[model samples]
Structures are given as C-alpha cells and as structure tokens.
Target: MKAKKIERKVSIALLFSITLLCCGGGQSLLAQANPAVFQIFEKYSKQKKVTLLEVSEELMAEYRIKQFKSIIFEDGTLALPEIRRCIEQDKQDAKKLKEATADGLVVSGYYRLKTVDPAMNRYLIFKVGKKNKVTLLYIEGRLTPEELVELLK
Candidate 1:
C-alpha cells in the first residue's frame, strides 16, 4: 500500500514536470508527439497490478534526459488494445526506428517523433514480454537515437 502511494506521487511529479516543460509558450512540446500514450500512464498508474516509475532528472542528467517515464502492467489484457491504438496513431508520423509484429499485431516497437527542438529527441518504446506482460516507456531528452539505443544496451 505504501509503495502504491509512492508510485502515485512519482506519477504526479512527472505530470507536473511535463506540464511545466511541455506547456510553456502556449503550446505543448508533447503535442507534436502522441499525447494519448501519456494518458495511458496517467490512467493506469494507480490501478491494481500496475507499476509506474519516473526517473529523476538528476539521475537522468548523466544521460541528458529531461524526462523518463515507464509503466508495466502485470496483465495487459485490458490496456494492450488501447496502447496498440496509440502506437498506431503515433506511427503515422513518427520515424520507425525498430518494430516487430507477431500474429499480425505489433508486439514490440521503437519510434522517434518529429519535434520542433532539433537537439531534443523524443522516443516511445513498447514491448510485450512473456505471459501478456506489457511495458511502455516514454523518453524525452537531448540524446540522439544512437545514444539512446546505446544507453538501453
């Protein structure tokens, strides 16, 4: 129960951070990307069997990331479809870095969205692991695609 509360606080802090960063200048930087995907984090972060984590800017400073948010669903039976839809929507305009489909469904994908800031890069990573477990990640930072991939490895 305490852990859940802490997770909620982290989620809220991330939201506040995003709002301050993205909502400046009368437009949101995330508006260029798919905001619906972020909604998934907010909608399910507090639900049972879900874990949401936001990496602190200080830890991410070494990587030059502004924000890093991740969510894992123990059983994504209910959220998978919605996540897929958002990914599909975002894919229409994003650069497809890496993608894999299983049984005619997207099982894993990595995408880079077009942003106004040339130095800043936004990435969305989605993966479905064993037993219907799903993981969704959003990363915003000044790191390039190569650097981000390297960091993941």
Candidate 2:
C-alpha cells in the first residue's frame, strides 16, 4: 500500500509539471507572435515617442506595419481641432472604435498618397475624457485599412 501511494504521488507531480510547462510555453508563443504590439505598449508605458520608421523591420513585419509613429499625451490634454484635423486628412472615413460623448473618442482610419507604390497610411487617435490625455499612432503599411483596424483593436 505504501509503494502504491508513492507511485500515485509521483504520477500526480509529473502531470502537474507537464501542465505548467505547456501553459507557460503557450503564453510565450502568444507574446512572441505579437512582439511589435508588445513593444509599442512598452514604449507607451514609458511615455516615449516612438517613430514607426525607427522600429525594427522584423517587429514591424510581424504586425504588417511598415512604418509607425506614436505620440503620447504629456500635458494630459489635446485640442479638439487637432483631433478633427486627424480625422479630416485625406477625407477618409474614420471608424469609431469607441463612442464619443462628453468624455472622448477613439477613432482610426487610413489613406493612401498618390505615389507609384501607393502605400496606405493608417492612423489611430485616442483621447480620454476632459483630461486631455491622448495617443496618436500613424502606421504606413501594406495591410488594408480594415485589417489595420482589426490589428489595432
């Protein structure tokens, strides 16, 4: 009976170890799959201005973002006209990711310049309430506007 109990305990320990290994591996894979996004989040947290062109090609390619520019709110506020200007450029229709009220707006859109290659330039504008906190990200890439929006979402 003592030997049987010891064997059962060992088996349970092995199973638990396997489970932990699998779970940890899965999480690492997910993080590696989107290194660009994770890197951007890290930069944002540090309140750094990240230029899309400055990012590594490998990281940018992972997100299909060929070029990216990012800005964070330093003074905790942005002017409404600036936000409007972002929406108006290229006259492209902006998609609302979040509702706009007395609080703020989260909008994204893309436009292509009249170039031979015709690379699409995408922008995501986020403003949080009256606090004037905002983040604007510009991405120039091969992905369609819809795909970019999905990626940002």
Candidate 3:
C-alpha cells in the first residue's frame, strides 16, 4: 500500500467523505441544492407521500421510512418506468427545472405545481394544454396533495 501525500494541507468544508465512502457519491450536488426533498434513501428503502396519507403495501411490510420520493409521472400516475423517465429527463438545467420540480408528476389535461413564492404571496404552477407547447401558470394555490388524487379522477 502507498501512503497518499499532499503538497499542502487544504481545507475541506461540508465534505462528507466518510458517508460517501460508505453510501457513495455524485448525489450531494442535488442535496445541497435541494434540501427540503433531496434526502437520499438506502437500498430497498420504503417511501411515503406526505399528501397521499397512505403507506405503500410493500413499504408497510418493512415498517420503515427511508428517504425516497415515490415515482410520479404525467397524469399523476405512479409508475416506476415513468418515474425513471422523469428522473432521467430532469437532469436538465437544475435552476430552470427548480421553478417547481423538473422531476414533478405531470397530470394530463391539467397543470404542474412549481415553486411557491409566499413572500410576494405568489406561487407558480403550470399545466401543459392539449395544444402544442401550450401551458397554464398558476400563481395561487388550487391543488393540494389530497386534490392530486381527485384531479386524476
């Protein structure tokens, strides 16, 4: 084995080398950028939706809450494949995407809930209309988590 040497002792800040060593890396960028919901889940961890107010059967069996967002897709459908598509497509411009959530669930014939700016009392949610590239932006609250289920109906 070879001892690694450095020309000078440099300062490292907010660097969790140990955790990454155990958990792996290339994800902190998302966490620091998105704190409220960027939490990482462990292998085979269970997930819950704050609004759905229900525990998934599989996760219920384990009786655990791990950091994992349930996969959501257009039409407010929860499908693994659609969720993966959203995740992969969301790797776009993080800032532009953060307008709400690039990886957010999109409901057909409806809109998407983006960032809510309560300061100016202004929040933004959008929906893609049937027409080509047409969208609707919402500045006020209309859809809640409970509403999500109903909206799909």
- What is the Å distance of residue 111 in model 2 from its true position? 6.8
Give the distance in Å from residue 58's predicted Cα in candidate 2 to where it truly belongs: 4.0
What are the root-mean-square deviations of the candidates from the true structure over C-alphas? 13.5, 16.3, 16.5
Q: Judging by lDDT, tell me the better candidate of 1 and 2.
A: 1
Give candidate 2's TM-score: 0.42
lDDT of candidate model 2 versus the reference: 0.50
lDDT pick, better of 2 and 3: 2
TM-score-better candidate, 1 vs 2? 1
TM-scores of the candidates are: 0.78, 0.42, 0.18
lDDT of candidate 1 over 1-104, digit per residue (tens):
99999999999999998877767853653545444588899899999999998996788999989889999999997899999998898888789999999999
* Model 3 stretches astray by more than 4 angstroms: 1-133
* lDDT for each residue of candidate 2 in 35-144, tens digit (9 for 90 to 100): 12234434444544322234544688877776665555554343444554544542344444444545254333233332224454444444443345455555556777
Model 2: residues >4 Å from true position, as ranges?
1-56, 78-121
Show model 1 residue runs off by greater than 4 Å: 1-24, 27-34
Per lDDT, the best of the predicted structures is 1
